[model samples]
Target: MPPEPVAGPAADIDSLFQRGYDRLYADDSTGAVRAFAAAVCLEPGHGEAWAALAEANGGGAAAVQAYAHAVVVDPGGWMWRVGLAEALRLAGSLNDAIAAYRELSGERADSAIVRLGHARALSVAGRPAEALAEYREAVALRPDDAEAALELAEALTGSGDALAAVELLQPLSRRAPDDAGLHHAVGRAWIALREPEKALTALRRARDLDAEDRLGAAPLIAALEAGEGADLSAAYVRALFDRYADRFDQDLLGKLGYAAPELLRAAVDRVIGPATGLRVFDLGCGTGLAGIGFRPLAGFLAGVDLSPRMVEKARERALYDDLRVGDVVAALEEVPESWNLLVAADVLVYLGDLAPVFAASAKALVPGGRFAATVERSAEEGFTLGPTRRYAHAEAYVRATAEAAGLTIRLMEHCTPRREKGVGVPGLLFVAERPADRPQIA
Candidate 1:
């Protein structure tokens, strides 16, 4: 039985805590959060109340902090520490989560949960080798644990061992015939194996079983069915960049040999000459890489990106006068004729329909202002989403789009934006100017 609310200030911490539990079980997370928050406010040192608050928040940064507080208040509580680590993982602090799990593993080497958590964090942080080792350890610790085995199989599939993944998943899928996640994993493995029919069957079954589509089987199913490319979802793009935010600079510059920013900078200079204090807007700025090169040319610089983590990284550079996390098109549409120069470096790959972006760019730029960008080159008639899930645009399409947007193309040249699989990716760098004499589109 739950405690009834007491009148006014007479409400005791116990009653509030009980009420929080009641609300939580009733699926009223917001109300539960308020109740637990009040309990903590009344008794700040209550570790259970703090932990309850953390759970109600569903593992955001506030949950991480709440769990940390609970761990500090109740150092002997093993589950509190685990909650803290899991909260960190869910909050996208992958490195911190890895460290927390590592410390926990040092104390309890035999815990399968800790090992699984560590493996997941490592996988997200792009350390596949370490993640594989951790997954193996977890499965070895608990051979009968279906979830752990499934994770290991997924990791194998991701690491390009689709055959091994299929072998491991076959028995598991047979045993748990109705398990959506298992079916989804099998679908992905089949996709990697180039068996589209098998992939579609598994994915459709997974999708039907999981009506909410929590396993993300719908997108895979759609891609396989269509046999053509579409614009990647905003959520998908945001999550990808957020996961890579920590290692973006190192991986892009050192591993991928990315040079879109430099390429765009040179082209902008050639088209507009030396910077004379222009108001620059960096579309999809991405950790301020383009902003850094354009800063010398700008009296004021503003930037926007889709990923909050990526925006945070860009903010740390302190180059932009204004930085926002939002869709590039929405950001440009917010204020028209506001910028003297707009730059997009390696940004268009995620977008298939460039019409909105080009129109927005034209509207955002002042009269005679320059817009510079890079696009992966496609020999096809229009644009195509490639195997890498990035869009590539044909040269003719770029010219047609710019002209339709009332911008005059000053330069469009072949260049290498980045390297993938040890080969330079073909790209086009273009500078288009919004002509002063042309009537502005309302």
Candidate 2:
């Protein structure tokens, strides 16, 4: 039940389409659709009216059909096809968008914007390698475009071409020398390349850029200063909690099934045996995930993280009696035996070696206080620091390190706490007690 195309004067049809296009431009969708429909009625073969109607309808199947009709009437209309591709993308019809973009490639062979859109659409369609090439092509065409360069870098990173991404982003970093996010991207890319020195330099730049912002460049700045041989960057550790600070509960709890905080709380309860009025510190509190679990048990709760973002998020929850933004170990060092319990959940994974943090925690703890932590489990020999630079420690390694730092491993449990890349990597949930007297064990 569709109206047939009416063939009329070209000027009349063009005027009708113009009216509809005007309505669309004014954000009057209902009036635009009516005007476009009327224009199509005036001249059934008018490509512009049909294309206008298609776009006005938000690129649904009916809209697509209208665009097809327009293309059939005027096959040389490249702009109409480009609009059709955008409409298709909006409709989530990626395959149709790809087809339209491919058709566009024939008409406008070297349009950078066209290529960039096509690349983004292709990436959304899960063709990352092809998308990467398209992004690279777009960047080559528009060398001065920061967005093109960033997209190319993102595509390369998504495709596991990190070294190539580094090569691209490093130069872009210079161009956008004051963009903290850009420096963060460059630093991450350098880390992927296993170039820590380069990573350090870039991350420091990020911190300096971030310093202008109120949250400050604490993450990048501290990491640059403290992250060195056998220690994780302060910024990197800060970033973990900061990135997840906002939507940690909904994302990690809902999607990833993260339960480390609660599990650690239960482990602490079992070991400590219902101790009352204990002063607790949640190191790397990270949006108060650990605080929520430990709050009931503690006489008072203090939270600390390197990221001010995470600190702000934690503050919103009002779980911590007090929250501080600083490096975990440094914060712990200043506490002066104020805490009877210190809980670090999945925080050590960001640290390659635990001796310094452990020593700091031991120093922070009151006599006979306990340190509860969750660590990523690796093989007996221990896992090497990967491109992410997060270390997965072996059971023996943790035990040895704990004992070396004058802490006694009271309990160790092997549990499948979380799934990574669909592989169930073992996790170590342990309660290590700092002795009343400093006792060094081998």
Instruction: Kindly list the per-residue Cα lDDT of model 1 for residues 1-442, writing each as its tens digit.
Output: 1122233565688888888899999999888988888888778888888898899889778899999999998898888899999999999999999999999999999999999999999999999989999998999899768899888988876655666677778787888899888899888877776557778988999999999999899899888888732346565566568768999999999999999999999898888787768999998888889988999998999999988889999999999999999999999999999999999999998888898898998999999998999999999989987888799999999999888888899999999999998899999999998999996555
Estimate TM-scores for all models: 0.57, 0.52
Model 1 TM: 0.57
For lDDT, the strongest prediction is 1
Q: List the residue pairs that clash in candidate 1.
A: none
lDDT of 2 by residue, 219-270 (tens): 5445545654344546345444555567767876666667788889889888
Worst 10 residues of 2 by lDDT: 1-10
Find the 10 residues in a row with the least total lDDT in model 1. Answer: 1-10
Whole-model Cα lDDT of every candidate shown, in order: 0.87, 0.76
TM-score of 2: 0.52
Off by over 4 Å in 1: 1-177, 180-201, 207-229
